[model samples]
Target chain A: MDNLKIEGTKQTPEIDFNSSTGILSISGRSIPENTFEFFNPVLLWLDEFSSIAPEKVIAKINLEYFNTSSSKYILEILKRLRIILKDGKDILVEWYYEEDDEEMMETGEDYEDVSGLPFEIISIDDE
Target chain B: MAKQSIYQSEIENLEESKNFLKKSDYSKLELQMEFKKLVENYEELIDQVKIITKISDRLQKKLNKTNIALEDSNIKLADLNDQLNETIDQLTEAKIGRKAATIVMIVAIALFIVSEAFIEPIIDNMFPNNFLVGLGLKLVVAILIKPGEDFTNKYMLKKARKEQLRESQLSHNNKP
Candidate 1:
């Protein structure tokens, strides 16, 4: 299947899901006008990718800001990743946040606990 | 039309379970299995609600902080803009004052020249013995210099302010 690449905008995050390297990345702000419309395809893509996933799959998430609805979608994404893990694939979620963004770090921890998935809460330098 | 929710499927599942429970089922195993499914769904739903609420609250706090910072920055910017406008006004006033002085000085010089070449001769012809009239004309010209400069300065300042208003309006109109 062709790789999924959605460009980032002022209101939405970028999504780059590579089937070859199995390095799925989501970055930038996500406050789309319609959260379901924006994330439905992402969830569908994850469902399709779960079957043909590589032995090792890494999901890199670096979001600057997201609204309440986007938070639910983020959970859904993690749940999908958990399924891939259940399929005997080595899955890792690298959640990146700014050094000073304590809220984002705590949010990542919450996801980690809720999803019961291996997560690396990485702190990155602020631009 | 109503907007679609992310929890539509979960809600549909719950509705189905409710409909199934309303029926008097024959098999105990089937009811037990359905109860188990209901419990699982409820647990998952609770977990989702818990996590989502926590995250939403944290993010809202972050957003509040950002908004406070932005407001502070805007206040600072407004102060800076006021200072800049005051400086520009002072500069424009000084510039117009200088131009007005120059114009008044030139008019004074031209009046002096005219008095010396034409007005002085005419006065002399009219009153050959009176030197006071010529001196009085020069005095009047000197007296008018201050008022002339004041008038010029006021006119230039008014024009400058009108131009500034026009430019500001043009910029405001041009903004997308």
Candidate 2:
């Protein structure tokens, strides 16, 4: 499987998925103009990755901000992770938020509850 | 949506499901098992969609805030830039006035020196002991001092105003 790497922008986040390392990371703000178009490819790649089924898949999501459409896509990403979880694979979702960002922390909790997946809600120092 | 449009999609979904009842012959027990399984899958999909919609909405709000902050910063930056340009223009005007004053003072001093050294001696010889010509020449420059400064000030101000007006007009036209 080829590694997936996407650069971050003012309106979008960065995506760095390493096939060899089994560590997928998405960080930065995500407020793309068209959420569906931006995330469709990323979802497809994850689907392909799930088939190969890496020994341990770790997904780290650290987002400062994201728009409504981007939020929907994020849920889709977590849903994909749930599928991998069903395949008897070890899946870890580490959700990082700013220390002072209570809203982001709450948002993470919502995802954790709904996905029914083990999610680690971590806080980092504010920038 | 209109009444017909609301039923359109639901009717389509039911029609597709009806195909199973039309062509397939199944035992009563088999039909019950299949219906239960179909309901289970649909319930799961609906739950997943619900979660996705909730989370996605929150993220979108955050994104909108970031955009608002960026716009506010841009407005502040434009205001500061306008203030800086105004100060620079005032400073330029002050500098021009200082230079004009220095030039005028230098010319007045040179005239006084020439009148005292050479013109006074020649005039005294011609008029036979008259110091009035020397006094008159000094008075002319002294009288002209204020007018000379006024001319310089008026000229510099006109030039500055012309340039400033063009800049202000250009900026106003571009203002959002």
What interface RMSD does candidate 1 have?
Answer: 4.7
Q: Give the interface RMSD of candidate 2.
A: 8.9
Tens digits of per-residue lDDT, candidate 1, B36-55, equal: 99999999999999988999
Q: Please, what are the lDDT tens digits per residue for candidate 2 over residues A24-110?
A: 899998878777566767887888888886889889999988766566677678878899899988999999999977768888998
The residue ranges of model 2 lying beyond 4 angstroms of the native Cα positions read A9-12, A33-37, B1-53, B71-75, B113-134, B160-176
**Candidate that scores best on lDDT:** 1
Shift in Å, residue B101, candidate 1: 0.3
Cα lDDT for residue B49, candidate 1: 90
lDDT of 1 by residue, A12-119 (tens): 999999987999999999999999999988888888888899999999999999999999899889988898999999999999999999999999999999999999
Best by DockQ: 1
Query: What digit string (tens of lDDT, one per residue) describes model 2 on residues B64-172?
Result: 7768999999999999998998898788889878877877788778878887898888888888777787678789989998788778877887887898799889999
